[model samples]
Target chain A: MAILKTENLNYVYSQGTPFEKTAVRNVNLEIEKGEFVGIIGHTGSGKSTLIQHFNGLLRPSSGKIYLDGKDIWADKSQIRQVRFRVGLVFQYPEYQIFEETVYRDIAFGPKNMGLSEQETDRRVRATAQRVGIPESMLEKSPFELSGGEKRRVAIAGVMAMEPEVLILDEPTAGLDPKGRELILNQIKEYHKTMGCTVLLVSHSMEDVARYASRLLVMNRAEVFCFDSTAEVFKRSAEIEKIGLSVPQITRVFNILREKGIDIADDVYTVKYAKEKILEYLKSGGKLQ
Target chain B: MIKDITLGQYFPGNSVVHRMDARFKLVITMLFIVMLFIGSNTISLEVGFVFTAMAYLCSSIPVKLIAKSLKPILPILAFTTILNLFMITSGMPLFQWKFIAITDEAVETSVFMIVRILLLIAGTSLLTYTTSPVALTDAIERLLSPLKRFKLPVSELAMMMTIALRFIPTLIEETDKIMSAQKARGADMDGGKIKDKVKAVIPIIIPLFVSAVRRAGELATAMECRCYRGGEGRTRMRQLKSGAADYVSLGITIFFLAAVIFINAID
Candidate 1:
């Protein structure tokens, strides 16, 4: 079942003012349960605006957002409940970490949900462990932690809520390569272990290609395409036209294909590209 | 939701007001404010109103923009008007019940005070509306250049003001971002009692303060890297100059002040 869906969502900034702008328009999308979806777009492509709608951080000027085939906005009193069900980890999540201790920081969300002290502690500890935060560090101040550690604690704070649908906007931004891989892998592990729906918004095509089962391409405030990872990569030319490139490995394969080499166009990662190149070299392929 | 603030917003235009020297404009604004206070009767108030209207017209700024500028101060205006209505005592009483008596003089004073306050805001808003913040700060530094001989850091003070003005919108944006992030984590900003609402702001304020300090530290380092020393022997990219229009504007402002003084003396 589609856990979250939007029909023709539209948003305008400074609505009546002379500086008014239509940020997101006519955006239609659906996310099924237990599916890891990746959203990719250039800056100012309405990616943030669209994700903001998923958690009700922003209301559409027109149209509806449905969660579990019911309107999320049906009951004004239940809007806060909807936010817990759809946890959104915004970019630079570290800025939102305010608790004196990492443990208290992680417990903030669950406590807000009115969970019992024991239950909140259990969930906070479980989430901290899940995100690989050391037990000793949980008692330390969030401000005293390193940048990457602070980020993990912040993500764990939302994860402690155990939302049915998780949305992370650029979770790996400003991290070193190892930090990036660790964070992405932790998110993938969480999705797998919890069997929850995940949506990752990223600028790096390679990151999306490596993790997401489905890809939703947004260009200029509209969905350019939404399909399986392999299917979306097939339209690499159209994606490139909008000032976004495909995965680096996919670009190399496209170059090889242009030279009449018998390589698959859908090879997006380095590991897959390596296998394809080895096969081509062994098959008596001539260098052009 | 906090992005709707229009405080200190500068509107760009190419009218005579925009072209007037910033220092001259600042001086005129001060004179206009002084004139607002000098009025003692209807005649001087009328003169002040006409001059303010003429200044607004010459700026070519839309009337709606000036009205919008007053949006944030409406509550203050209402409160002051109400307080004046209760405090003033003179003339025929309209309502008398125990300690609270609304008199004709109270009514008159309230209306006049409200009008004076609104006109004060509108007239000063004209300076911000026409002059960009950068130009305004530059003009302030130049106007205060004489204080440099007294060992005052005029340029440094102006630079601090410039950075503060530049960052108001940015900090507001950061606050909005932090609030949304916390809201996503189920930090309930709404649907709370008075105590709960104030308590809920703790999460918001902590992060905001931390980020503001971080930004300040980063900005300080950046300034140091750019070799930004104090006002000593510093040169500006945009130099302040007084032109024919500036002289004309100053002359008109002086004439208006003279008229206000004459009306005050006669009244």
Candidate 2:
């Protein structure tokens, strides 16, 4: 069953004013349980606005959102309950860290959920361990930790809620390559271990291709395409036309295909491209 | 909802009001405020209202925007109206109830007080609405330059004012983002008792304060990198100048003030 779904969702900023802007218009999509879904779009493409709807942070202007087969806004009083079920980790999550100790910061979400002290502590420790936060580091002030550590603690705060659907908006934004890889890998591991649905919103196509089972493309407040990663990569030209480029490996393969090379057209990662090239060479295919 | 705040927002335009020197606008606003309170009779108030209306017309700003400026003060206006109606009784009674008597004097005073408050806000809001914050700060610095002789940190004060005004929108946006972020983490901000509402806001205020201090530190470092020393020997990109329209405006304002004072004496 789909863990989260949006049906004809629409959102408008500054509605009924001169500055009114239609941010998301008639977007419909579904995330299967335990699926790692990636959302890609350029700035102002309404990607952020769309994911914000999944957790009920933003109410739909005209449609409904379902979490675990229930309308999130069905009971207005229980909207916060929906949020607990759909965890959202915002970009630059480190900026949101404020507790004196990293442990307290990570416990904030579970505490707000009215969990018992023991349960909150257990969840926080479990989440911290999942995110690779050291036990010693959890007792230190969040400000005293390194940038990457602070980010982990912030992510753990949301994870402590043990949400059924985990949504992260550019979780690796502004981090070094090593830091980015660590954070992304940790998130993938968490998703796998918990069997939770994960939605990763990113501007980097390569990152999305490496993790997400399916891809959703947004352009100008509309869903341009929603399909498997390989299927979306087939429309690389259309994606580029919308000011977003496909993964570098996909571009290289597309170029090779245009030059009449006998390589698969769906190559997205560097390792896959290398293997495809080796296989083509061994098959006595000319370089063209 | 926090993003909808338009208080102290400046609309950029090439109108005569936008072109006036900030210092001159400040002085004129002060003079206009004094004149607004000087009117004690019906004829004087009428003259004062007409004078403000003409000034408003000359500013070329929409009257609706001026009216919008009164939004934040609606409660204050209502409170003052009620207070004046009940506290002042010196004429023919309109109604009597227990210890309170609604008199014609009370009615007149309430009307005059409400009008005075509205005119005061509308006239001053014109200054902010027309002048960009940077220009206003520059004008303030220039006008207070004489205070430097008394060892006052006029330039520093103006610089602080400028920075504060510049960050109002940014901070408001940050506040909205933080609130949404917390709300996404299941922090409820709506549908709660007074204590519950306050408790719900803890998640918001903590993150907001943290981000604000971080932003401030980053801003300070950025300023330092740019070699932003104190305001000594600083040159302005847009210098203030008094043109024919400015002189005309000043003259008209002075004439209106004279008329109001003269009318008050006659009444």
Quick one: best DockQ, which candidate?
1
Ten contiguous residues minimizing lDDT sum, candidate 2 chain B: B1-10
Find the 10 residues in a row with the least total lDDT in model 2 chain A.
A91-100
TM-score of every candidate's chain A: 0.96, 0.97
* Local distance difference test scores for all models: 0.91, 0.87
Give one digit per residue, the lDDT tens place, for model 2 in A120-177.
Answer: 9899989998889889888899998888888888899899999998999999988899
Those runs of model 1 whose alpha carbons end farther than 4 Å from true positions after fitting are A274-288, B94-101
Q: In terms of TM-score, how similar is model 2 to the real structure?
A: 0.96
- List candidate 2 segments past 4 Å from native: B191-193
Look at candidate 2 and tell me the lDDT of residue B65: 79
The C-alpha TM-scores of every prediction are 0.96, 0.96
The fnat of each candidate, in order, is: 0.88, 0.68
DockQ of each: 0.86, 0.70
Q: Over the true interface residues, superposed, what is the Cα RMSD of model 1?
A: 0.6
Clashes of 1: 0
Put down candidate 1 lDDT per residue, B140-258, tens digits, no spaces: 98889899899898988999999999999889899899999999999888866999999899999999999999999999999999898876787877787779999998999899989
